[model samples]
Target: MTRKIIAMAATVICVLGGFTASASSVAQDNPTVKEVKLRAEFYQNELDLLLDKARRGNFADFYQDVVKFAHYGEKYPQYLLGVMLLKGDGVQQDIGQGLVWIRLALEQKNTEWQKVYDSITAKLTKEQLDALEPMYETYKARFGVQAQKMSCNNEKMEASNIRIHQCRKTLVLKEFYSVYEYN
Candidate 1:
């Protein structure tokens, strides 16, 4: 049972995008880590699966999740948000918004997505690009992100190890970029 639980937790962590330095160095508490781990599980099974559903040609569902995921600060969703908005896939065509989303995606990681960025840029005029500045600032402000501890309440963390828990959250004081949360 213990081995099984450890394996399950490890799998969930993989699905949650794995451990981060911030998650490890932030806090040293079992309860907090447990909750955050639950949040990660939720993120993987729910949000990640939603993206898969969208890929199967569910635009309406895809668009809905995209709106919520826009605030989640992950690369793939941000990229998708950009592409869909740019091409008017389901949401209204908004080149400026597309640029913002794609750019935000780029900021998340250095990936092989330059082509997408290039394709979008190729079509924009200098004037349009210039005009995008104001809106871009607004988008950037909203989309700006930093590493944050995934959170859950005490009840949620009952399964976590104290050592594991300590390495799972930020210990120092922080004004986090985003917290994985559901209402």
Candidate 2:
């Protein structure tokens, strides 16, 4: 699981190579960037645990963790929370809310998520469809990428003493890795 996350990080680093920074630069006195990295690491760790629990079929615990992660503007957890809500896995079934969560995740522009979004929306009832707009607006305002300030725009990642440029170039070259490989 940890390996999978690392591989995913590596892949994202590759795709976001333009955002890479020198280790020395990242180690400088930029408190805001430092804070963002710290928060990202903390959330990533929590997300790893949550994913592990989901893999173990601990839906109840997974649901609780997903709620927290989704609130923190994590896309994958928001998608999972939506699935849970749609099926009432650990909470009451709420189609509208479920769609909203999936919509939020899809807004991040992940193609895989789009498949899920399309399939679900294709079968929605009239009331469910009606509820989507307002709910989507509300969740979007609070959990959307822009609101969360999620951007790959020159964000620094920890690479110890290694030059981020070389490291990212290598990782990006091998695009076969999937974060969901283990799952």
Which candidate gets the maximum lDDT versus the true structure? 2
lDDT of 2 by residue, 1-183 (tens): 333423433343344332212233112232221112233345457779898887786677667678766765677788788777656677875555766788888755666667766755555446546646765765666556655545422223486543221110111223321121000
Clashing pairs in 2: none
For model 2 the local lDDT of residue 137 reads 66
Candidate maximizing TM-score: 2
lDDT (Cα, tens digit) per residue for candidate 1, span 90-155: 776555566667776666443345655655455555765676565555444444454333232223
lDDT of 2: 0.55
For model 1, give the 10-residue run with minimal summed lDDT. 163-172
Per-model TM-score, in order, reads 0.56, 0.58
**Clash counts for the predictions, in order:** 9, 0
| Candidate 1 clashes between residue pairs 3 or more apart in a chain or in different chains | 24-167, 26-169, 26-170, 26-171, 27-169, 27-170, 27-171, 28-166, 34-157
Question: Positional deviation of 48 in candidate 1, in angstroms?
Answer: 1.6
State the number of backbone clashes in model 2: 0
lDDT of all predictions: 0.51, 0.55
